[model samples]
Target: MKYPVTVYGDPLLRKKAKAIEKDHPKLDEIIENMWETMYYSDGVGLAAPQVGLSIRLFVIDASSGADEEPELEGFKKVFINPEIIETKGDEWTMNEGCLSLPEIREDVSRHDEVTIKYLDENFVEHTETYKGFAGRVIQHEYDHLEGILFVDYLSPLRKRLLKGKLIAISKGKVRPHYRIKVPK
Candidate 1:
């Protein structure tokens, strides 16, 4: 079943997520549910906290947009307790949106490449480097585990301008196509 996405104002989104142990209960089932929720919401990436679980986990599937970025074909991955080892290359801007902050998209700047260490669904370790679109997506989702939001990267003036919209989202005044859990 698809979980209602935990929205922006939820305190869960502001807290650092916990790492998952190899023997975490129902691990496989959780991953499957996350994928279902992500696809159902038309999200390229979904972090555990976004699903009301404060765990260091996220999934990414960018293959749906492979036509524009051929390298993203089959770029599906499951990250458990991911650690970003290095972020290099010039910073670039990309218009990004999040399921947690529905209807809000902004230009966010992030590194062009990143090297990370993470365990896969089977608890197998893998260290990989990604660049361009894949790298940006990874960085975005990784930040969620750190209790950071993409809007935090915006300039002060921009943030002030968006304050009203942000509050509206928190108050559950927006109508996103997918289900969402607003802050109490």
Candidate 2:
């Protein structure tokens, strides 16, 4: 079953997610459901926290952008208990959106390259290096596990400018294409 995406202002989204053990129950089913929710929401990536589960898990399938980013064709990954071992290269800015924030989109700055250690769906360890678009996507989803949002990377003035919209989102005043769970 697809889970509702957790909206902004929900405390769970702000909390640092926990690590998932190898023996975590029904992990495959949960991951499968996450994929369903992501595609249904028209998102290329989905973090466990976005679904109201504070676990260090996320999935990415950037194939939809293959037209513009040829390297992204057939690029899919599952990162569990991920750890960023290194981030190199100059920071780059990119427009980003989040399911939790609904219509909110922001230009966020992030490292151009990164190396991370993580577990796969089968709990096998993998240390990988990524650059450009792939690295950016990885960093974005990784931020969710660390209780950070892309909006947090904006300048203070920019954040102030978006305060009202952010407030509206927190208050469940916006309608998104996907189901969402707002703070009580």
On TM-score, the leading prediction is 1
Question: Which residue runs of candidate 1 sit more than 4 Å off their true CA positions?
Answer: none
Taken over the whole model, the C-alpha lDDT of each candidate is 0.95, 0.92
RMSD from true fold, candidate 2: 0.9
In candidate 2, stretches whose alpha carbon ends up further than 4 angstroms from where it belongs are none
Give the Cα error of residue 147 in candidate 2, in Å: 0.2
Error of 1 at 159 (Å): 0.4
TM-score of model number 1: 0.98
Tens digits of per-residue lDDT for model 1 on 67-165?
988988898999999999999999999999999999999999999999999999989999999998888989999999999999999999999999999
TM-score for every candidate vs. truth? 0.98, 0.97
